[model samples]
Target chain A: MKFVIQRNQLIASVQDVMKAISNRTAIPILTGMKIEVKNHGITLTGSNSDISIESYIPAEEDGIVNVEQIEEGSIVLQAKYFPDIVRKLPEQTVEFEVDENLKVTIRSGKAEFNLNGQDAEEYPHLPKLQTDDSFEMPIDILKSLIKQTVFAVSTMETRPILTGVNVKLNQDKLSFTATDSHRLASREITVKADGINDLNVVIPGKSLNELNKILDDTEETVEISVTNNQILFRTKHLIFLSRILDGNYPETSRLIPEQSKTTIHVNTKELLNTIDRASLLAKEEHNNVVRLTTLENNIVEISSNSPEVGKVTEEITVQSFEGEELKISFSSKYMLDALKAMEVDEVNIDFTGAMRPFIIRPENDDSILQLILPVRTY
Target chain B: MKFVIQRNQLIASVQDVMKAISNRTAIPILTGMKIEVKNHGITLTGSNSDISIESYIPAEEDGIVNVEQIEEGSIVLQAKYFPDIVRKLPEQTVEFEVDENLKVTIRSGKAEFNLNGQDAEEYPHLPKLQTDDSFEMPIDILKSLIKQTVFAVSTMETRPILTGVNVKLNQDKLSFTATDSHRLASREITVKADGINDLNVVIPGKSLNELNKILDDTEETVEISVTNNQILFRTKHLIFLSRILDGNYPETSRLIPEQSKTTIHVNTKELLNTIDRASLLAKEEHNNVVRLTTLENNIVEISSNSPEVGKVTEEITVQSFEGEELKISFSSKYMLDALKAMEVDEVNIDFTGAMRPFIIRPENDDSILQLILPVRTY
Candidate 1:
């Protein structure tokens, strides 16, 4: 492969693919990134077993990229060295040339480097998924959906399927659900995909995390494609593919309740701060549990007691209250997560007895809901 | 002890003293902060065996502080809990009271906390040092002096003395030296003092690091008092005490030479980048060594070769040359450090010989100097 590319453009593309390359790969060849130069542009691919990323740089981008030679060829260079070399290049433009024996040469200004290259044929190829099922959505909405529910996924790998977030779509609505048995987060959004059938897939939470880091917070649309086992998300010049878990996701519909014995409306910030204070003491306990009690006269008392560490009690005034007064004990972290996911200023928390799970949602919006199972503090 | 103080003021004092308190202290009382309430104001102190910090909050500070009680007493509370509790308090003014039994009550607005407090008498007392030798200097200059030389201290504790920075005062000049034997960094600054006496002390690098974090970048003068075995630094309302290491500092003055055979002047930034790029390939080698060779046409060549990895070569333009052309190889990290510490745009390097040690300093200034021993590359 022989070509010349801009410093910034190459750095951006290399950074995207570097996310998929792991330093601890058992297979030595898996650590290298495949580079291909054609008439159109240059394509870089990097993959582990779980996720794969492919980035492209056009031959001409707003007069930024200029390819001097049209030599169509491919080679695999060490991903670890390529990015560092490009980032620290002393010149504005970097030149690349490959000899007959596949020895790659990179030069910028007066600095020159020669790295032994491996045949690109030795690198594993990503399974090409048929674009039979594809959809497009705004990048902002997708990022928000992932942020709200991905954190609640089970980090323990005992049940491999539970480590992923389950996505369900029906024509016009998309639902995302994540639960670790103790706490659950669910969000739904409406998209403009016509003539698409029902879709269900389980994507690993770790893959979404990597995707989030490279994604810029812009209003551009991202095209998503899925096959039987592999799913692909394509943006302006980047493609992200993740392997899907093949298993039946648990039925989470029966977990959320329809009614509650008591409900309280409180300012989201006020309740969040009170719980944060109580957590300082409760964090020393085994479950980090804090108790919440609804008192008369529009007052709510939050208390956490650790026999070893002292006790903390706080009183916050709620905006309004109705129904029977109740007392509940749950993990302080769960409460904090539920409060943070809500976007509205005021939140309404519905309690169904002491032991039953409770639901929290924004006072004005019903699309985002969070549920937490109370801990047995007896 | 009973008192009410502004939250921000108390938080500031608590953070300042918390730096001295260690979580893994051998003595239980050492894990707590001593709080004393006097008729004039409140004082907080935290101490480990190596260092102690004390901060005072007066009864009234420009009408920002208010004291309600004249009670005078002292108690010690767990340093880990008190800081978090004070930071998360719900009111602007927090009320604190300790009974004769050492039980503490902290109340602010509708929140209350009851914590176990130990008698102040159980806390370790700081050593009293006689202030016979003292001097004062600008805090900014002192901070800069510490930052420029502390990073070169030997991290390995085999030679305990080398783990500290040696500061020696002679006549009107103060010199700081640090080394791990492989590389050494030293700088001298001029200061005015009334007494005519020479002094030398080795201060632990870890303590200096913590002090750096707490010292603000201000032009105010700080009074420094050196005793037989301890040093104390006093600012407006803060007192910092550190135990000095015992033993004599090695004679590094004899290591620097007064003559040279070759000298090269180059832009500090240009040479820094060249070494940085060379290190990328040299990193694969065990020593991360790079070679620099001066040519006849005011040109410098930087190169690194790793048998298993690859090789890289770069050239940097030099402004002027003197004496004979020379080539030397050394750790890239040492050269990078020397360049970073330089304040002037251009630097002059003196080469005693091809195998002998070399010196680097600002072209226009003589206050700072760096020396590096060449590595024999076969």
Candidate 2:
């Protein structure tokens, strides 16, 4: 096999596939990246036990030749060295040649590398997903949905099913929910579902995180398919597949409070800054609890104290306040994360009571909700 | 004590002094930063066993009122949290007050912090350095000198003296040298040392590393004084003091050869890149050996091999080559470091023989020299 490809384009594709490659994989062949060249384009695949990523570079596009002198063949090169070599290649174009013995030779300008190549047959086959539960959405919307809900997923392995974002679609509205049994984040978006309505899958949060990075924030639409065992996200030239958690995701609808004893509309930026400052001392405590107390005239005071360290208090005048006088304590980290994810200038925080879970929502927008369980700091 | 200061100015000074404060320090007081408020300005000090840094902020500078409501007093606050607090303060101006019980209160906008402050009396006093062996040089020049030589210092404690850069001033030239037995880096700059002649001291590489970070890159002259036990670098608003490592530096004058058997002048960038690409496979070898073989027509070949991984070979054309046919192997890491330190577009590499130490110097310049020992491969 022989081929010459543009170095810059090859580097980008290599990096994308490299995201799914891991050095700690139990299967030795999984540590290598499989390269397959055809008359049309070149495909690079990298995979671990849980996730697989494949990126392609077309031979010719828009009157520009990205690859030439292609001979159809396949081989697997050590992922550890291939990415670095491609990045550091000297010239704009690089040439690759494979001998009958599976020896790989890569040449660019005056540099030449002879690497030991593993047979492509040893790599685990990545079967293409076939299902009718496929849907299309703008790439940016998918990225935002992942960002809003993925952070709240359980990081511990005790509840392995909770380590994924539960994606569900019902009656023209699609929602993503994640919870570690402590705090829960749920986001809903209105999608025009013509034939696909009953789609539910739990994609590993770690997989979504990697997928978010690989997916560009573009207006172009991406196709997503879900099967019983796996979910696939496909773009024009790339495909990302991940194994889904087997257990059923818990029903989280009852965790969010529908009624509030007290509610206040506050400047999101001001409150975020206040919580961040107060958390400096709160971080010493294992729970990182920061107190919020409502005062007269729409003013809310946020404070935290560690006897060994010190105390911090900040007062922010909310835009509006109603219901009853209230005081609540919650993890400052959870609050900060939720506030950042709100992505709005102003938000309404509703508190059912001092001991009950509270929900924060973007003003006039019911599509996104962040619920936090308050600490009993009596 | 009470003072209101511009937040930006305080933040910069706080960062500078914070470099000296380490939480892992054995002395508990060293973990806190001492703030001394006087009628003129405020002084912030942080110290560890190896280095002490003091940064000052004046009450008014160049028609700008940086500090107001100043009441002279002193107190120590935990350095771990103070920097973060100052950085995240809401308003441009921050005010501080201390009660008789040493409880400190910091306020900015509507945010207030009450921190536990230690008595200033318990803080260790830094004695001002008094020495006639003092010289002044541009801060940028000093920064360059440090960067060029400090990386060669030995990290192991086997030879304690090798961990510090040997600084010597003879007549009109100031030189800095560092070596870890296998490789050496030396840089010299012409200074107007009239009153001072024999200023020789060994400053710890770790201390110089910290000092390099605290010192800004500017043409402003910084006053430097050297005592047997300490070296001081003083700028207008900052004073950096580092304890000198106690030992006699090894005689390295014999390490550099006066004559060369063969010398080659090559493009510094091209050679550096070629070596870097070849080192990808070389790194797996404990010695990281990459061979340089001189070929016909001013071409040099660089190659490295790890039998289990693969091999890489790259050839670079030098501008001029006047050398006997030489094939020498050396650590790619050491060679890369030396080449990077050369800081010149063209360099002349002088090799006495394959076994003898070779020196690399900037073309047409004698101020900087890098020498590396070749590993025996045969």
Candidate 3:
């Protein structure tokens, strides 16, 4: 393989592919990135067992030539040092050449590096995902959906399926839900879909996090295709593939409360700040439990007490209140996580009782919801 | 104890004292910060046996009120959570009141935190350093001197005394030197002194690192006092005390070479970048050795070769070169460290053949000098 490429373009592509590369993989060849030189452009691929990423640079695009003078061949280079070397090269353009014996030489300015390359034939082959169950959505909106629910996924591997976010589609509505038995987060959005509907898939939350980091916040569209055991997300210059979990996700609809004994509307920022301060002492105890009590006036008291280290108490004025007065205790970390996910001026919290789960949603929008199970703080 | 202080001022003082606090200290009281309310202002102190830092905020300084409503008393609060709490307080001013039973109440806006406080009597008292030998220098100059020599200190515990920087003062000249047996760095400056002519002490490098972090970059004077076993650095609002190492520092003056067989002048930045790039491949072999050879013309060849990995070579133009043609190999990391410490446009390097030690200094100044021992390469 022989090619001359722009240094900046190569750096960007290398970084995108490197997100899926991990040094701890059992397969030795999987730690190397495969580079292929073709007539169209150069393709870089990085893969572990669970996820694979491919980023391509075109020969010429929009009156600018990113790559030229190509001799078609393929080789796999160690991912550990290649990216760093490319980033620190002193010239604007980098020249890469691989001999018939797979000895790769990279030269830029007065600096040159020769690295041992592995045979590309030893690299694992990526499964070709072919299915008509594909859809397109704006990258920013997709990123928001991932952010709203990915945090609620179970980090513990006791139940491996809970580590993924449940994605379901019906008609033109797409819903993403994640829960860890203690709390749940759900978001819904409308998107244009193809013929295939009634599709469901469980994608690991870790894969979504890596995908979200590489994706730029733009109005450009990302095409998503789903198969039996794999899913692919394709953009103009990148392609991401992730394996789907093979277990049925637990039913989470029954976990959210349907009725409320008390409802209160409060400024989101004020309540978040109050709970944040109250949790300081609670963190020392490792429980991070805070109690909220509704008062007769438009006021709510948030407090936390640690037996050895004293206590903290704060009061916040709510916009409105109704139904019966109530008191509830829950993890301050979970409350903060839910509050941050809801980007609204005011939030409506619905409480059933001291022991039942409570739901929080935007005051005027029902597209997103968060529910938390109370902790027994007696 | 009671006092109301501006939140920003309290945060700054707490951060400064926290530099001396360590979580792994043997004495439990050392992990907490002592806060004393006095008629003039409030004082916060943190200690870890090796170092103690005290930061005071005056009731009124430069026509601005930082503290008010002070009742003379003192209490020690847990340093782990106090800094975070003070930073997140919601009001401009925070009121702290300690009851007779040592129950501390901190109030800001509508938020209140009650924390258990230990009696200040149990805290370790800072040793008073009474010495007639004292000197004054600009804070920025002192900070620069520490940075130049601290990196060369030995990190191994085998040579306990080498873990500290040797400081010597004579007449009006002060010099700092540190070495790890392989390389040495020395810097000297002239400061105003009183009552002392010859003095020598070794301060632990760890303490200097913490002190350097808290000291601001300014032209204000810092008063330094040296005793038999301790050194104190006092600024306008802070007093930092460090225990001196209890051993005789080795004689490093003889390590510098007296005469050289060859001398070369080069731009500091160009040599640094060349070495950095040449070291990349050398790092894989766990021995970062780079070789430099002086050619006939004003050019130097920098190269590194790893048996498993390939080799790299680059040539850089030098300002001037003289003496016998020579080739030398040394650790790129040590060379990089020495080059970074010299804040000069051009540097003069003197070599004594290929086996003896070499000296590097600024082109025209003698205030700073660096010596590096060459490595034996087959």
Candidate 4:
């Protein structure tokens, strides 16, 4: 294979695929990126056993990519040294030529590098998914959906299913849920779909993180297709695929409390700042517990204590409150996480009891919610 | 002790002195900063047994400070938590009060903190140094002197003296030298200290690094005083004192070659880039050695080779040359450092032989010079 491409265009695409290149050498072939040239464009794909990313550069575009010579062939080049060489090249265009035995030569300006290459035939093929159960969503909306709930997913290896985000698409509404038993985050949004197809696939949280890093903040649409064991996300010239976890996800719909004996509305910024100050003293504790008490006038007391580090207390004039004069203790870190996920000025927190689980959500929004179990503190 | 100070004023002083407070608990008293209130001002000091810093906040400083209650007393407070607490306080002015038992209460807004404090009598006082031998220089010049040559100091523990930078201030010029036996970097600058006493001292490189972090990018004057065992740097409200190494520094004057048979002048930036590119291929080699050879018409050829990782060659045009054609191999990292230290458009390299030591300095200036020993490569 032989091709000459613009430096910036090749660099942008190479960076996107480099994220999926395997850093481990358990399988030596997995460390190389497979390169293929066709009459239309050039494609670069990197894969491990669990995830794969493929990006394409068209031969003729809006003056971004200029292809001088294109020979239809394929080769696998070492991903480690190839990207560094391209990034540091002193010229605006890079020339690539591969010999019959797969010894690739890269030339730019006055510098030339000859890298040992592997046979592209030895690389594994990516599974092709049928488009019968595909859906289209705006990239911005999809990015927010992943960011809002992905952090709460269980990172431990005990329950393999909880390590993935559960996506449930029914009719025109789509829902995403992630939980680690201690806390849970859920979000629901509307998307456009062709036929009535329900997808209840569990995607690995780690793979979603990689996908998030590669997805830029653009208004374009991203088409998603799922097969039996793999799911693919295709953009303009990028394709991201990940293996699905084969297990049953827990029913999180019942985990959120339906009733509350106490409700309080406080400024999100004020509560975040008060919690941050209290955390300094509470951080030494194993659970980082902080207590909150609502008074008659619209004032709430936030306090934390440590046996060796003293205690901290501050009063925040809340917006509104109802029900009994309530006092409860919970993990400061968990409360901080729930507060950060909120996007409005004011947030309402619901309390069922002193020892029961509670829910936190934006005061005006009902599509997103966060739940945390209160720690027993006397 | 009771006083009220502006938040910004207190924060600035606290940050400067906090540099000497080490996190290790091996010395318990060293973990706290000593606070002393006098009729003139309040002084705060922090030390780590090796270095001590004292910053003074005057009673009336251009209407920035307002001392409400003046009680002449002293105390020691924990350094780790005081800075964080002061930074997060909700008020513009912070009130500090101490009880008979040395218990300190810091009040800001409606929040209050009671911290355990120690009597200042137990804190070790810094050695009093008379200003018999002092010199004044521009802070910018002093900072530049430290930054240009400090990175070459040896980090090994076997030879503790090499871990410090040797400073020699003569009648008209001040010279700084640092090395780890493999390579040396030296820089000199002429000053206006005509009648100043000649002095020589070795200061720890780590202390200079901390000092650099606190120095502002202004043309303020910095008064430097060298005592028998301590060296103090006083600038405005900050006083930084560091313990000097108690050994003779090695004489590096003879290491610089006085004569050269081969001299090549090239653009500093061009040479730096070529060395960086060639080093990429030589990274896996034992010493990361890159070879430079003089070609016809004064063109310099830079190349590197690795049997298993291929080779790279780059050609950079020379501005001028008055030497025999020679090929020399040296550590790419050392060459890069020498080139970086010379702040000039073009540099002249004096090479005696392929295996002898070489000198690199600005083509127009003779104040600063960098020397590197060539490595034998077969």
- Local accuracy of candidate 1 as per-residue lDDT tens digits, B298-322: 9999999876567889888898889
Query: Model 2 over residues B1-378: C-alpha lDDT tens digits?
Result: 999999999999999899999999788999999999997999999999999999999898789898999999999999989999999999999999999999999999999999999999999999678856688999988989999999999999999999999999998789999999999999998999866888778999999988889888643988898776989999989999999989799999998999988899999999999999999987765478999999999889999988878899999998888858898999989999999988889999999889999999987788999999999998
Model 2 interface root-mean-square deviation: 0.5
DockQ for the candidate 2 complex? 0.93
What TM-score should be assigned to candidate 2?
A: 0.99
Give the alpha carbon lDDT tens digit for every residue of B225-268 in model 3: 98888899999899999999999999998888888999999999
Count of backbone collisions within predicted model 4: 0
Local error of candidate 4 at B14, Å? 3.2
Give the interface RMSD of each candidate: 2.1, 0.5, 1.3, 2.1
Classified by CAPRI criteria, candidate 3 counts as: medium
Q: Supply the TM-score of chain A against the true chain A for every candidate structure.
A: 0.95, 0.98, 0.98, 0.96
Write down the C-alpha DockQ for each prediction: 0.67, 0.93, 0.76, 0.54
lDDT tens readout by residue for model 4, A190-260: 87777537889899999989998999965398899888899999898889999999988999988888888
Q: What tens digits encode model 1's per-residue C-alpha lDDT throughout A1-378?
A: 699887788888899899999878987888999998999899999999889999988887776555556578999888777888899999988899988888888999999988888899999878987765788888988888888888889999888788898988887798888898888999999987763568899999998888888777642988887888988988888889999888988999899988889899999999998998888877665477899999889999999887665788989999999889898899999899889878679999999989999999987677898999998887
List clashing residue pairs in candidate 2: none
| lDDT at residue A254 of model 4 (Cα atoms) | 88
Please give the distance, in angstroms, between residue B197's alpha carbon in candidate 1 and its true position after superposition. Answer: 1.7
True contacts kept of each: 0.80, 0.95, 0.77, 0.42
lDDT of each: 0.86, 0.92, 0.91, 0.85
Candidate 1: CAPRI quality band: medium
Tens-digit lDDT track of model 3 for A288-334: 99999987789999999987888899988899999998888999999
What TM-score would chain B receive for each of the candidates shown? 0.93, 0.98, 0.98, 0.93
